[model samples]
Target: MTDTSIPRADESLDDEATTPVAVDEEIEEETDVDAEEANGAGREKKSPADSELFRQSEIAADYVEGLLDILDYDGDIDELVSAGRPVVEVVGGRLQSLVGQRGATLEALQELTRLAVFRQTGTPSRLLLDVGGYRATRRKELAAVARNAVEKVKEYGEAVRLDPMSAFERKCVHDVVNAIAGVESESEGVEPNRRIVVRPVD
Candidate 1:
């Protein structure tokens, strides 16, 4: 998450860019992930301590570890800073239940982990939680989907509606399409059913 280049043509959501994924009901309270950055919106902020973010990731990782223990699941946890945000990734076998369908369980668990961090730090965080490499794999799939949608829009000059996706998935599509020229994308509808429409830019 080093703010890597996001130029188009064979690029992906992993191009070192972070998009605010749509918040599930569980994270509505934490939807304002920008609050920390916004605190210094009009002023130069002193470079934040990297340890703070790392500590946040550590706390989240520990919380996740404890959760795995309760569930009797096995996984290896890695906590690190990516693009200046705390990220906790869990990798292991037979962890599909933790990821749930389309990552709904993962999202809820993320909120819980965040709550744990807030309880410990007294500060709201923008930490990201990934389980079973779901997000990474989803990003690649969405990138392909985005590229295909853009190709259609460029060739036909029409808007294409994609299947409904979670906020995280939608943001992945948007990031891919937004990096390309001659096409643009937007989300329509509401939670759980919201989808993306890619259109040719006139």
Candidate 2:
């Protein structure tokens, strides 16, 4: 999950460093509206996509803040709008454990945060959550892996099976293959252990 609370393009690093967001009213209002539309069941919730995006960031920020406080980690939470999306970034010392090896911890955290957003909004959120810039780094690596798979498929004329990855990672690979010519990708198996298969375009 990439950071749902990303800073706007013009927001400087200094602003991010100094600003502190506690409960965004815009988000609370949007979530309240969604809750009303959900009708106590998982029914339709009419809300602007952007508002849903904001709620995701707000929920994620709350989750991360609680985690930091419990673990006794010191990091300032910076929330802002970036690239037409909300993003929350945590920067501080001794925080690498939150990222975990291969970003397993970060992925878990994202799922939990998403659940939190769903519970509050009564509707699923499309929020991208990121911590320690792990997703950004992983994206570059996944793109490379996708290209390599495509090359192998072209050279050997056989499908390529990639190691199981989280849903976000699979989506990245799928997106890469989907954008390329003469290749295709699809996910197979159950999640937390799902895999991706790349094949030649028919």
Error of 1 at 197 (Å): 1.1
lDDT of 1 by residue, 1-202 (tens): 2211212345443322322333542333221224434543532332466678888898888888878887899999998766556889899998999889888888878767766676577677778898988877777888899999998988888999999988678877877888898888888888779899999888
Please identify model 1 stretches exceeding 4 Å from their true place: 1-48
Candidate 2's C-alpha runs over 4 A off are: 1-49, 81-86
Separately for all candidates shown, the number of backbone clashes (residues 3 or more apart, or on different chains) is 1, 13
Report per-prediction Cα RMSD to one decimal.
12.5, 14.1
**What are the Cα lDDT values of the candidates?**
0.74, 0.66
Colliding residue pairs in candidate 1: 1-83
Lowest summed lDDT across 10 adjacent residues in model 1 is found at 1-10
In TM-score terms, candidate 2 sits at: 0.70
TM-score of predicted structure 1: 0.75
